[model samples]
Structure formats: structure tokens, C-alpha cells
Target chain A: MATGDIPQGGDTIAVIGGGLIGTSWSALFMAHGYDVVLQEPAKAAWPAVPERIATALRQIAELAPDLPAAGQLRLTTSLEDAVEKAVWVQENAPENVPLKRAIYAAVEAAAPAGAMIASSTSSLVWSELSAAMGDPARLITAHPFNPPHLMPLVELFGPDPDRLETAAAFYRGLGRTPVFLQREAVGHIANRLSSALWREAVSMVAEGIASVENIDAALVHGPGLRWSVVGAHMAYHLGGGSGGIGHYLSHLGPSQERRWQDLGNPALDRATQDKLISGVGAEARGRGIDELEAARDRALIAAQLALSGQRP
Target chain B: MATGDIPQGGDTIAVIGGGLIGTSWSALFMAHGYDVVLQEPAKAAWPAVPERIATALRQIAELAPDLPAAGQLRLTTSLEDAVEKAVWVQENAPENVPLKRAIYAAVEAAAPAGAMIASSTSSLVWSELSAAMGDPARLITAHPFNPPHLMPLVELFGPDPDRLETAAAFYRGLGRTPVFLQREAVGHIANRLSSALWREAVSMVAEGIASVENIDAALVHGPGLRWSVVGAHMAYHLGGGSGGIGHYLSHLGPSQERRWQDLGNPALDRATQDKLISGVGAEARGRGIDELEAARDRALIAAQLALSGQRP
Candidate 1:
């Protein structure tokens, strides 16, 4: 646990916080056969963590039936006991600067010297989080997609190449695709693109070009399916016919720019927000959040299972 | 063929142009039991048409095993012969306005007066194309996604509700999802959102935030997978946790706007184009367009088949 080498299977890793993301991350780690010491101060939330992680583990097991036996999970209320002998620590506290800095101070004091501390932060950047850390180089921002256990993307950014590569290798071993940023950017790669798409989506609703149901339907049935197989750049590359993306840029670049120029920049004013809430409500058709999340997880598993055997 | 009612199964539908889109449309129509009259001005494109369509049909057949017996296909060089007896004329000419206008004139001259004339034009708006048409009310822009047979989206826009409704019903009968636009937008609904997403995607690469491979990998593994099951609005809806999109807009709307503001407006300059060509080439890993397209089609079919039995 005290080795400087990258943590591998059977290594004891500390997973701090027992919220949804923490539980999901712990499930992913345990399913991959790594011992997890989960720490959470709120004893009330501790009882539900096991069943939640077990459900997530079951979902992953369905897709990958040949996984190694799960590792041991020890729950604790004391942060020091959780990170005492750990070689890696994954912190999933809420995104508050003062609160996270306090946890990091606690972790640095108790965790083993060579252990890598990773932050599962989606919105906050590494600079802001690392500014208050004792050994700033020890912490790396590893932002997993929402519902971390089901989705495979983990965006990693830090100053140390060795640590980044170590984390990248570790994630890849666990069937996660880790995308590294050369420099820190707000929202990173995937969220930026998604936000841009949603902006235009909101504008379309606000302008009444199409209803929420139609737009959502169009996406699920159309480009969204293709996106599941290829990213935006590669989609256009294939769209260029036999000529590839070069041909697309040469011939269709003007048209793409025109479309970009025409794209809307609607503000999230009260009226626009009202339209969004109502529009998505109609699209939901009375499905509650739990039902919707269940449906989404099921579809994600099925779709990934479907695409698993095929090449990307 | 001359009836004003919507075209149903066993009816003759003319699929003009023997290119990929046209041939895929023919496959979809024929697979659903509609007799097809495919017209290609160049006889050089003739011998390859049927085989291409048969391949696409086979892909669809793998997913849907209980399809009706395919309708008869009659290929001809004469435009008049192709549309003379058809009740639904689906035109797939190139995007040249004058050429499309000419084809429309000829289609109007020969096809049944009451037949719905649907244009598979992706970018061109209804007003622009309808201006020169003999019966503008008959022409509805029914733009299908690329590889139309596999993709389910068919964006429909027309002035006349009866014609639009008829087209929508016919598409629905063929197991296609037809999303109607309340007003015509330049790139319609799906493509505009896609374009917006790509602008940010391209900017990420151009600004050296990440390599194209990582950015694409992030997307395919993360948001793209979620998107395939749910659309942007609905995904955000679910992201609001138990509170739904109402809570999301109220709580996270400010951050979303901040991300949107930081989204890039990258130009497809010479240098950027070179980066794209090289980057996608690396992503392709020496596979040609044919290989990529085949892989994309296989993934699409498999993914669709996977999600077919599951509720969305």
C-alpha cells in the first residue's frame, strides 16, 4: 500500500465520501477487484451505500460477466482510518473550495506518502482545488461522467506526467477511457460540447422551431445514435463521403460555418427556463426522476453491451 | 396511385436518384412492402444500385427479422416513366437548387396530381425550394439522416398540414420517426444541435485542449452513449436528480451559461483543416472510408437492435 508504483488490482484504495458518485466509484473499483476503504461522516447515509453499490456492481457484471471476484469494502466514519495505509485515494466531496481543502489537509496528514489522491470533480478545475492543498502535485482531478459506474469516460488533468499516466493506465485497466487535457479548461472536453449542444437545443424550443418532444425524438433516433459509435469530428469525417474530413471541410465547411452563424445564443431567463421545464416535462410524459434514471441506466447497459462486441 | 389518401403498403413509390441516400430510401420503402421505381439519369450508376440496396436491406433485416416481403423494384432511366404511376415521389437529387428545381418540374409533370412529393434535402429550406416548384404545396422537405435506411429520423417540413400529415403517417408506417418543424430552420433540428456540438469539439482540438483522439474517445465513451439513449434536454432533466430539469435550470443554469460563454468559435482555416485531416486519420488508424462506414453501419444496427426491446 505504501509503494510508489501505480496501484493495480487487489491494491487498497481509499474512496472518500459515500454519496452517489462515491458509491458508484467504489463499485467500479470493487468490481475490478480492488479493496476499498469508504469513508463518510454521515452515518445515516452509510446503510444505503452497500445496496446502492451492489446494484451498480450488478449492472456492470451483466455487461462483463467474467470479472474477477470483488474486493473487500470496509466502511468507516474516520477519514484517517480510511486513508491510513491506502496507496490511492478518490475524494468525491461536494464542490466547495473551503470544504474540499479541509478534507485534503486531513488526507495529506494521514494517507501514505506515495498515495495518489484523485478528485472526482465535474465543474471545479484543478488550479482552484490544488491551490490550497499541502502537496499540490499529489492531487489530480479525475472527473468521471455522471453516474460514474455506468459511463466509461474519466477526464483526467494534473501537473505530473507520471501521476497522470499512472491514473490513465489504472482507469484503462478498469475499462474506463481517460481523456487527458494538455491544459485545464472550464467544463473540460465533453461537458463543453454538451453545453454548446444544449444551448442551441434550448434556443430552438424558445424560438418555437420545434417542440421539445420532436427535438428529443430527432436526436435519439438520428445523430445521437451515430454519436454513440463515433464522436463529432469522426462523424463529419465519415460524412465527407469518400474524401474524408478534408473533403467535408473543403466543400461543406462554408455550410457548416453558415449553420454555426445561425445557431442561437439564448439566455436562461425565467421565460426560457419555464419553457424548458414544461417542454422536458412533456417529453418525460410523467416519468419521475427515479423511473427515468432506471430507464437510462438500462438503455446504457444494453447499448454498451450491443456495441461492446463491435469495433468503434 | 392517383388517390388523395396517404400512401400505404403495396403502393408504388418513386425513388429518384440511384446514389447512396436514394438507394437507402428505396431499401427502406421496399423493405416495408412499397413497390419502388428508381430513376437514375446515368446508366453507369445502374448495375451497382440493387446490390447496394440489398446490402442495406440485409443489415436492417438482421435487426428486424419479421419484416413484410419486399415490394418489387423497377429501375428506369426515364424520369417520366419512374413517377408516372407513383403516389409518393421521394426525390434525392444533389443540393444544386436549379437541378432540384428542374427535377421537381419534371416530377410535377408526370407524378399523380395528388401524390406527396418529398425532397430529401438536408440543408435547403422549404421556402427556397418551393418557390420554383409547380405545386409548392405538394413538396415537403423530408430529410433523412445519412445512411437513411439505418437511421430513423426523417425531418419533415411543409406548408400544407394534410400533405405533411400524410407524409408523417407514411414514414411512421415504415417504422421511421418523423419530427415536424413548426418553422423551417436552416439545418433543421438535429443538425443544428449537432453543428453546435461540433463547433465546440473542433475548438477543443484547435486550442490544444486535447488531441482529437482523446476528445472523441471522451465523447464516445461518455455523453455520446447517454445521448444515444436520451436526448440533450431529457439528459439534463435526469441530471437534475429527483428534482428534474426545473431544479437543474434554477441551480445549474448559471454554470451552464458560463460554459456556453466559454465555448469556442473556431474557424476551419487551413491550419485547422490540416489538423482535422491528420487527427481523424490517426483516429481512423489506416482504415479507409469504406471500412469506417461499414463499422459505423454495423454498430448502428447492433446498437439499435440492442435498444429495440428496451423501453426508452
Candidate 2:
């Protein structure tokens, strides 16, 4: 991988939206000593996103002392200005397909032809998102977890394998680990796995077998930590010890089949709805989305920065 | 939860055993300021486990400066002296039914009735383990995650309800959050959830749907982080948004049902075994059990200390 070709110096990178993710992108790029140009026409999300970004940058700066200065990010109201002459454009606009198409058209017009354009869409397929772009090959899903300034992972998915490699290099240039998904599934890699687990968790809760807190406890204290390090396969592989995954599976496989058969298949009923709402509301204790999101962002920043060392 | 009930100035809490979970228990207790009395007869394990525990404790001390002095933990060979009048006895013996029964019996004799005897058994039912004890009530499963010093959760299980409360109170006193299982199940909560996921991951790997690393990436980068806070049910609730778990269940539940039906119940074939091993081996290449363990302990300390602030 020609990591050096991704530009290490002060090349301008445009952040096309100033929402939580866009501002986080700006802070991350600036931290790596890139010149970030952030544009937010909403006028309202302005300053708020940047301010939140500032708090995150300060934490990152403290935690990662050797990291390059992240104080060079500039915010503006003009999308054209942000996109012009940039080496890379990271679009974090709203997920409305039509609006994204218009934004991509505008970005392609404003940015140089050689510049890379990546979307931060969590669910939208790259084929659909980049269809309107002049050079759709460079348009990939460079989806970072919440508070990108902190979390070290970026899920890279799209057509154009070569461009995906280039996008991966770009993120790695900024000290982010990129996992290239082989296909453009709805949830991509992380969300799909998460959706699977969440599906079972919903079934459990809806079935009245476990409460929200208990279920969360089951994960956070239990396999959650293990998953953070070794993940499922490695964990069970080690769990099998010298026997490896095969021997372990041979012994435990039937039990798993049994459990699967016995597992509850929860459905949406009046009982389930009330149980879920009451369960989550009690756990949340009625915090609004903004407050909960802000708190989650702060925590996620701390968590991702902590795991940055484990980047392989 | 009475936090101050914890001894203000104990240098060592005896940890009997030097196995994976045992070593983790030693490191965490030591990391939290109590000196650890690690009693292991296996001379090879003695040198390695303490070194591992010390490395882990130091990492915890780095992330959380408030972590008490861990320098006081000591290793010894005498099981008799290890538990003599100790404030707490954390037993990490082998998981055999007879072994647990015998160890707790000895531990009951060595320590005062008041001194807590906690087990790190993942699968053994508490009633069986505590049956031979004079005070069966004192024996409770403080089933910690592997590398206990790092993971923030301890599953508290016992036949006696009052003792379970006491065990919970004691773990809480030490800045650890304890979740009480109303009744003992085979793997407790977290492992069971993980087993379910691992079973599915194995099925996926067996079916050639995704590689091992891809599956691991999907989880750690995606729902894993989300599970750290809100857990599975809440994630679905959020995923379903205003539709709630009820709507999600009615709509997505059948799809999961379909997936469940489609799930490959392949026996642990040779190819399947090889795939799981190759996948996990590649992932575990750089990270030894010791290194990943220490990191896990540090994160655990950080999480538990953070959560301790939330307790009323």
C-alpha cells in the first residue's frame, strides 16, 4: 500500500456538513495536521458542532500528545468554498437521497478531479449515494463510528476496488484503521453484526426473559469486553483452548443447536411495546435525544481514543 | 451500596489460583488498591501470572490515576496461609464440579465465616459448589469476565439470597459493579449471549458468507460499542426509532425468523473447523493472552471506576 501517496502535509479537506459526524471529521483531520474546511448552511448546527469538536480535539490532544496539532480547522457557511481546491472531501450531510445527490453534484463541480469524495452514510448504499457524482469511483462510504475524532475505525465500502484502496489509505493517513467491506450491504459490516445482536436482544426483552439493564449488563460486563479485544471467533477459538474452534464446536455445537431451537422468537405485541418503552425509558430516565447523544459522543470519544493503540 | 465499608488500608486480598480467571481476579483486586495474595503451587504459573497481573495493574494505574497502589500484591505457595484471617478470599480454581466443591470446603475452613468466599465459575451452578461448605451462604460466584482486572462486570450468583446481596455489596464496595442472577444458569448472562452470537458467527463462517476478520470487524466497530452503553434491546428500540421495538418486531422479526431458519446447522465439519481456526489465529497473531488481557483489565478499571460514580 502506497500510504505516502495519500498526502501527509497540510492539504485542505472539506467537511461538507457540520453535524456531529462532520465536525468530528474536521477535528480528526486537523489533528493529523490537515487543513480542514467545514461548511454548514444550517446556521444553527454551526458553532455547536464546531464547539463539540473542539472539546473532543482537546481530549484527543491530551490523550495523544504526540499527535500533530489539531488547531488549524476552519469553519465556513459556504459549501463551494469548503470544497474548492481540497485534496479530499468527506460528506456528512443528511441521508436524504435526493439532497445527497445534489450535494455530490456540487462537490464534484467544486473539488478538483483528482480529489477523493467519501460519504459518511451509515445505511445508504454507496452505489445509490454516488450515482450523481462525475467520478463515482472515488465516492465510497468512509463511515466512521460516532465521534470520528476519537474512534479509530472507519468502515470502507463501495464499488471501485482501487478507489476503495485509495480511500483506505487516506483514512490510514489520518491514523484511522479502515475495514473494507466486500459488499455494500444495508448496515455494512459493523451495523449488520450489531443489528443481528440487537434483533436477539429485542426478542429477549419482548419475550420478558430479560430487562433492558440486565441485557446491557449481560453484554457490557460479559463478552462485550472480550469482543473489544479478540472478537467472537478468536474468543471461542481460545475458549476451545488447544482444541481450537473445531474441537470446541464439535463438543458445543449441539448445545448451540439446542439453544437456538429453545430460543424465544419475540414479536411486536401491545405487551412487548409497553415493555420496551418502559424498559428503555426507565434506563434512559427520560433524557432527550440531544442530551443522550451528546453524552454518548463524549463517552465514545474517550473509548475510541483508548483503543487507538490496538490499531493493526 | 456502602462504599466506605471496604477496608481503608489492606495491602493484600488473597487470590487462590493462577489460571486465566484467577490471574485476572488478582490483578483487578490489586489494581483497585488492595494488595493481592496470589497462592499458586504451579511454579511456572506463579512467575507468569504475577508478571501478567502486574503488567495489567500498571495499565489500569495509567488510565485511572486514582487506582490504589498495586505494588503490594504478593505470590505464595501455601493455601493454608493464603486464607488465614483474610478479609476476602477470591477462589479461581479449576471448573470441575469436585474441584470447586473441595476448594470451597478448604476455603471455608481456612477463612473466618465473615470473610467472603467468591468463585469465578462460569458454568458451575452455585448450589453445587457451596454444598459442602459449613456456611454455604458465604460462598457466592463472583463470576468475573476473563482477565478480571479489566472487565467491569462480576456476575453474583448463590443459592442463598442474603449472601448474594452481601456479595453484591462487597463487590460494589471494591468499586466493581455486580449483577445478580436470580437463579444460576449454565453460562450466566454474558457468556450465554456470547455463545448465541458465537454460534451464529460460526454458522456464518461455515457457510462462507463472510471471513472471520470481517465478522469480527462487523461486531467490534458496530453494535459492540453500542452494546457498551444501551445494549441490544435499546439499540433495536433506537433502530426502530419512533416505530419502537413493537413495530420493529412485527416487521423485522419475521426476517430474523427467516434468517434463523436459513442458519446453517452444519456439524463441526473439518472445513468449518479450519476456517474458524485460520480466522481466529490470524486475528490473535500479534495479541497474546497476556497483552490483550492487560489491556482488557485497564479498560475494565476505567469503566468500573467511572460507573462507581453513578451508584446512589
Return the TM-score for each candidate structure: 0.97, 0.73
Candidate 2 chain A weakest lDDT stretch, 10 residues: A1-10
TM-score of chain B for predicted candidate 2? 0.85
Q: Estimate the overall C-alpha local distance difference test score of candidate 2.
A: 0.69
lDDT of 1 by residue, B1-312 (tens): 543487878989999899989999999999988999999999999999999989988987986778999999999999999999898999998887898889889988888888888999988999999898877988999999998999989999999987788888889888888999999998898899899999998898899998888888888898888888999999998888788899999899998888889899999889888888899999999999999889989999989988875746
Model 1 root mean square deviation, Cα atoms: 1.6
A1-312 per-residue lDDT for model 1 (tens digits): 443477888889899999999999999999999999999999999999999999999998987899999998999999999999888999999889888889899999998899989999888889998997878989999999988988989999999998898899888888888999989988888888789889999999999999988998888898888889988889999889899899999999988988899999999999999988898888888888888888889999999998985855
Instruction: Choose the strongest candidate by lDDT.
Output: 1
lDDT of 2 by residue, A1-312 (tens): 122247566788888988768877888888888898898888777758767777878866855779866637777888789888688889998878999899888887877777777889986888898777777777888888755765666888867777777877778777676887666656555655564565466566765545777777768656765565556776665566456666777887676666655544555556866777777777666775556555655555455555545533
Q: For model 1, what is the error of residue A231's alpha carbon versus the real structure, in angstroms, after optimal superposition?
A: 1.2
CA lDDT, every model vs. true structure: 0.90, 0.69
Q: Please give, for every candidate in the order listed, the TM-score of chain B alone compared with the true chain B.
A: 0.96, 0.85
Q: What DockQ does model 2 achieve?
A: 0.26
